[model samples]
Target: MHDLPARLPGAQRNLLLKHLPEPRMLCTMRSVKLLPGTAFFTGRRSFAAGVSKEAEPLKKLVYISQSNDVFTNLALEDWLYKQGDFKNSRALLLWRNSPCVVVGRHQNPWVEANADFCAEKRIPIARRNSGGGTVYHDLGNLNCTFFTSRDEYDRKANLEMIRTAVWDTYGLDLVVNKRDDIEWRGQKVSGTAAKLGRDVAYHHCTVLVHSDRSMLQKALRTGGVKGGYESKATISVPAKTACLREAEPSARVSDVMNAIGRVFLQNPIEDKHGNTVPSEAGGYQLLNPSDYWFPGLGSTRRDLASWDWVYGKTPNFSFSRTYSLPKAHNAGNNPQEHGIASVTVTLHVTNGMVTETEIKENDSFSQTGGSDLMHISALKGQRFTEHLLDAAVQRTVSAAMNAYPRGSSGNHRAFSPGPRLTQRSLIMESERNHDPMDREYVNSILTCA
Candidate 1:
């Protein structure tokens, strides 16, 4: 945390110091100074002369983000947490994104999101600087971030402010659960997460107003097979989610945002003398996120949108897929040619890059050459992405086809290369085949997650 100047510029100092209550909060506008490693207070002494003086009354602000981009909004939060002075002020930031899946700082995007679905729909994913469960964000979902000094950081207080706002404005009775999420009739309508800093802290949460629940469910799931990905990343705790509009049809994102902002500013701020003081009401400021307003903010947004921070930061994990090779339909009743063969490919990934590859074939009748390993070795330093993984598998299968010419039973059994082995391929084939176990297999992966 950068040390505040001994005194602010004349105009700014007057603006901040004017809010201090007289007598108790004593200090002339020009005499105020902020020493390093000390709370913002007037340079005054108590009756004993050596005792600490009371600090100024807190000033509160409410800011509404003008941009809907997830990375830009996240950058605003980072800027406020790191640069904003919260010693005498508390701030509330309300924002909404176009359509994105936000994962926690310690989360794995591959495990928390459906890569194929996100890619097909073109919904970007972002990793926040807070540790919590994953969440889906859209224009209909309202995101709230409360900023305060580290000493005044309180997650419950922030949650209660939201709960009060919802109930008071919409007559919706919401309960704050043990996990800090606000529930409507036992279904979660809001989820909470927070980031703490040395001098500042912010608690952010998501409130579902009228988001697409179907898309939320599909986008939050991964395409990986069950028991395939093994990671130590923090997995999200699944919950039965509900939107505020579900109970109250008229509930709107704007109205809810206004209500929350109103409640936040209406609350009183206390001075160090235990006096309840009216909070400095800085009505909602429409924040246009840019480098002009917040220096180095563009860099922060870039980091949030970069691959190194998104997928490359994922914890080390391993994924294994086992699939059977379909035999030729023309091979009639010949047990030797009809042998059941399955191939299992296990890959160990570190820092979102393939570090190890293992391939094994369970063939009862014949054995193929080690040509597949040659192609698999190329994946050692490649990214553990669906596109790269698919390409590698296809190259391996293509090599196998060239090694043994099809329709030639002279040298060895004709090798039949099946569909490219991938998470999406397994899902599509498994579902199209209508195997009950296939359905169960896909659903079993997130049990541990």
Candidate 2:
């Protein structure tokens, strides 16, 4: 962890000092200073200090009002990451952004979104550095971000807190489904995703109680296969989404917000952490973090909004099909003589060597020949020198020849070669051959037969 500055510029540090009820909380914020230009509240302690010689550290809570913009959320997350707040404090941020489609970091947004539709409707698209499917958000949706120390964070526990809060507020039994979705009456109402940092983590989720289901359906259309090529991509099965208002006609966004606030207020007391404010001191005031906006920080409107980052990150591979003539197909008199024995192999290659392979063949030659070509194609990108290929082919051909007598008709049987080399390796060899700036191309010779 980077050491925090001893003193920060301006009176922002003083704000925290003034708000803190207990003197000990100052020690925690004293080491670091807020950035020179930003405004932050200081000096309000979250927990009461004990008089005993050994006192437990007071817990700090920062409440931030929600923004209806995607860029604002990204900016807050980025600022928290830089300030190291993710390591020290727990943050509860509330925001209901305009309609948008948020995609996981490793996901292909093109597969998860209807870009043209979203563009036409003016709905923003965001990509987060988390592992999960895409989710839809709108003003009617509530987004809660929980930032906590990695060591103390429990995803399930945090989710349960939200569940308990909703249940207590609305008397609805929202069940957590197998896919980590919060559902009511078989309709999905919320979805969550988490991003883990080195010493901290951020878990955020969307509550869909009042979002426009029709808009979501229209904005999340699936595009057909790409490049006249068909390969598996991450897929999301659309489901019926409902808002809390549908089930409880009396429910409002304000009611939900109050329930959430109650959950946070009751948290400290329930956890055996005494409240710093006395009963006479009254209910804790929920203060909104100062508003600071920067257009450059809006990734949803810029980089994430681009197709290059969403689709270009996908790993590239090639699938090729080859065919041969079966003995029956080769015979002039046979009716099947014109039929072709075809094989289609799909190869996945990374760093040159094939990592995965699949093969499919026609039914006519099934009995005569069928091998795990899928497994063989896996060797397509494996580094093999000319010497190695020559040796292996010779050894295999010699073995097959020795098995049959030279005078036998079977001895004339032709030997079929293995799968072709992967494109990456061919490109590397070609580059090495023609590039004037090329350095030595290291060589490896395989003696394996």
Candidate 3:
């Protein structure tokens, strides 16, 4: 045998020295040839091989699902980031939702929602966890979610990938509009949002190809004076919104979805650990709970649907404003009944501003009587503003407190300050409502701060 000194490198020799195991036993059954130089080199090779075997391999391809609701999709994406599930996998989520208006997580829903219009049409209003403006969606809309480990997540690159996928499948040159939307020609076709987490991030977009345009318009009211019920809310600019059918006249929702799937399948990349990763690869799945219908879907629909979550979460406060109006004769047969109207209004509020207001009729001898009372009541819970509060006070004077027809009266009286609650409070309540053993369920989902 060759001498070990002739083959073993100095670094390898030093490494062996550092990790040398304790000498335990020696056997002397047979006479063996002493190969002075070969033992060290052979031992070093064995050590190197052992270290390689001990290392863990990286995971690739993360399975994701298409959700049926926008809120559920947003919630699940938030859940994935908090769970650190994106540490080593890439996710593809498919999702859709009923006709509704969705506001960016940081946006004010009141401003984004057309309360009068939405209420008339019975469109649901929801807030997402991502940062963006308001968007409308229906069954015809398709939502896509892309999830990746925090270290590997790249918002710009991911967006490009999506743009490329659409272009490849439809042969349409879709441009990223306003940096947050995808547009065909000059009209917006998709609205995008993103949420970042400690170990992962998610980017989702609403594809309004074949969505119901009329319902979308009805669900999202575009024009309204800013303030009061509409204060600080996101407003959609008037635009001739079009569906994929209207735009292409030949494209369908399924056609776009299929095209997306094809693009992802055709393009694959290697993950951080050098493992080959596939896009839109099948194997993506979701963990179905005992109640699959609501699996991963929270009780938000029920809780938020309740007046408790909807209005009860508002902060506590009040608004006060004084107004003076010139006297005028009644248009009816009562000229002598005409008199100057003077009013001082006080409103109760909660949350960040006035969520509810209570108007105290300070002067009983005023000409408008309780006519102004109806208008003051409407001002409650509305954000405090010089202009809005003044207008509300004026409406009260015009109607003459009693002039507000019964039933025609705004439901301002129906609002009540029940309890002060937050997202945390709701989660706690949900846990108490379930079995103690399932507390983990609450813990797992309560990850969103």
What is the alpha-carbon lDDT for the whole of candidate 2? Answer: 0.51
- lDDT per residue, candidate 3, 316-406, as tens digits? 4334544443232233434344433344555554543455655544334444455435656666555544445555543433334223232
TM-score versus the correct structure, for each prediction? 0.75, 0.54, 0.58
* Number of clashes recorded per candidate: 0, 15, 30
Give candidate 3's TM-score.
0.58
Q: Where is the poorest 10-residue window by lDDT in model 3?
A: 35-44
Most lDDT-accurate candidate? 1
Off by over 4 Å in 1: 1-55, 222-227, 269-278, 325-341, 361-368, 408-449
**lDDT tens digits, residue span 112-176, model 2:** 67767887998877876666777888888887766676765566656676788888988888888
Error of 3 at 291 (Å): 4.4
Q: Rank the models by lDDT, top first.
A: 1, 2, 3
Can you write out model 1's per-residue Cα lDDT over 116-203, one digit (the tens) per residue?
7989999999999999988999999999999988887888878999999999988999999999999999999999999988999999
Q: Which residue pairs show collisions in model 1?
A: none
lDDT of 3 at 432: 49
Between candidates 1 and 2, name the one with more favorable TM-score. Answer: 1
lDDT for residue 240 in candidate 2, whole number 0-100: 70
Off by over 4 Å in 3: 1-67, 223-240, 270-296, 300-337, 340-349, 352-449
- Model 1, residue 14: what's the lDDT? 57
